[model samples]
Target: MPLDPGTPAEAPTRTAELKVRGLTKSFGRAAPVFAGISFEVPHGASVALVGANGTGKSTLLRCCLGLIPADSGEVELLGQQTGALGQGARRRLRARTGMVAQSHNLVPRLSVLSNVQHGLLGSGAGPRYWSHALAPRRAREAAMAALEEVGMADLALRRADGLSGGQSQRVAIARALVHAPRFLIADEPTASLDPAAGEEVMALFFRLVRSEGVTVVFTSHNISHALGYGDRVLGLAGGRLAIDADAAALSERDLGALYG
Candidate 1:
């Protein structure tokens, strides 16, 4: 059985954080996307999950987030077993975590403030209503604070569809941060941006990790960028965790083997 967050002697010092053990996912009876993958991300650490396309990086993330069922494994979020959680339990679990995918899934017609306010809808504060009349003051304050953190507060009244790709991505990031999640998982956050934009986004992500003490796990294909941004790099190859090491400790040859 997976452990729960408590003062148990066996629990890690920071038990209220993310943990994955023996996680495996498969489409059918064939080989798994990943088998026996295990890793622990302590609170307030930034970890980069790196691998080539089709290596199951996104699959692993989806499984971890309970978006898809894992073939066999255990996932503990904040010390609770998430693999076996029911819908209600999963919903509550997700409330404490945030995700930013490559695609900024924003409502095109909605204003930036409206889009950011949607992040608070899952908190069960109340029923959903029209964006104009439903001025959730606390939620708006939090959303604006998050936007300020990402330097997008000035565009809060603008339509999401009118923003540039980078701006939209920043809004997405702001939405994720508005909830103050204990864990933030970003899947290829910079994949759609130019090099400079990617670096700016990455820098903002790291700044959040450092300033807010939030645990961050992000997926990236650019090895150099991953190395530059991540404290630790987890390399997935052939549906398995092939390499796990400090970014500074890895060499070009090591990265080559992991990719090849």
Candidate 2:
């Protein structure tokens, strides 16, 4: 379908899908980072965007999330054209999306529950008036439930800064889910964790996809993880999409080319 410029919130179609068509981006007069980048993530699918460092994987994600404007092309989330929306409309759309980054992006001093509750801020249900006080009972309850999903509910009272790297990543995952977003974007979510921890986190992501039907688009440099966990794998090289294929069908040689 051609991308529509209006809000999809009122559209009768399912509001849990993402589609990009001819997406192009560039930093300056240089050639575009990606051109004619097109893909569709159906509801509840888990896809990986794989590439070497500096291949514009992160940039593509940021552009999809409206963090940066695309020089041209279409980004349709659910059914709305994201690139054509105003700030208010974009913010409304973002409330339905969740993102996890390698850095965790937590406030060090806050308790895990508090950090998770911040996810509700975008939805206007957060305790923004009393910044120093605890989140309201209902918000805390929801945050705790989200933490439980990531197996971090037991550590909800701990300061975010005190947690181990794996635990912190779990907390970040919980924060992302607290809003009950329809789409999740994770950028190198397990980059700082050990092998076991990475596996655990990826398993949790699979569980979410199966149980909650959340659509996930994540970037990863780990070929094994991409093959093991992703339904589809997209390869970016030299600032463009070089390959798009089923993860189960790709050979090691194909991945080697992406890295080389």
Best by lDDT: 2
lDDT of 2 by residue, 1-260 (tens): 75586845564544448888898998879888888899888787888999888789999999888889998898899779987798888888999999999999888998888888888888866455123255567787888899888888888888889999899988888888888898889999999999998988888867875688888899988888788778889999876678889988997688878887
- How do the predictions measure up, each by TM-score? 0.90, 0.89
Q: Once model 2 is optimally superposed onto the true structure by TM-score, how far is the C-alpha of residue 179 displaced, in angstroms?
A: 1.2
Task: Identify the runs in model 2 with alpha carbons over 4 angstroms from their true place.
Answer: 1-16, 126-132
Residue 238 lDDT, candidate 2, scale 0-100: 77
Which ten contiguous residues of candidate 1 have the minimum total lDDT? 124-133
Evaluate all candidate structures by whole-model CA lDDT and list the values in order.
0.83, 0.84
Off by over 4 Å in 1: 1-16, 127-133
lDDT tens per residue, model 1, 111-193:
89888877776666555422624866777788888899999999999999999989999999988887788888999999999
Candidate 2: pairs in clash: none
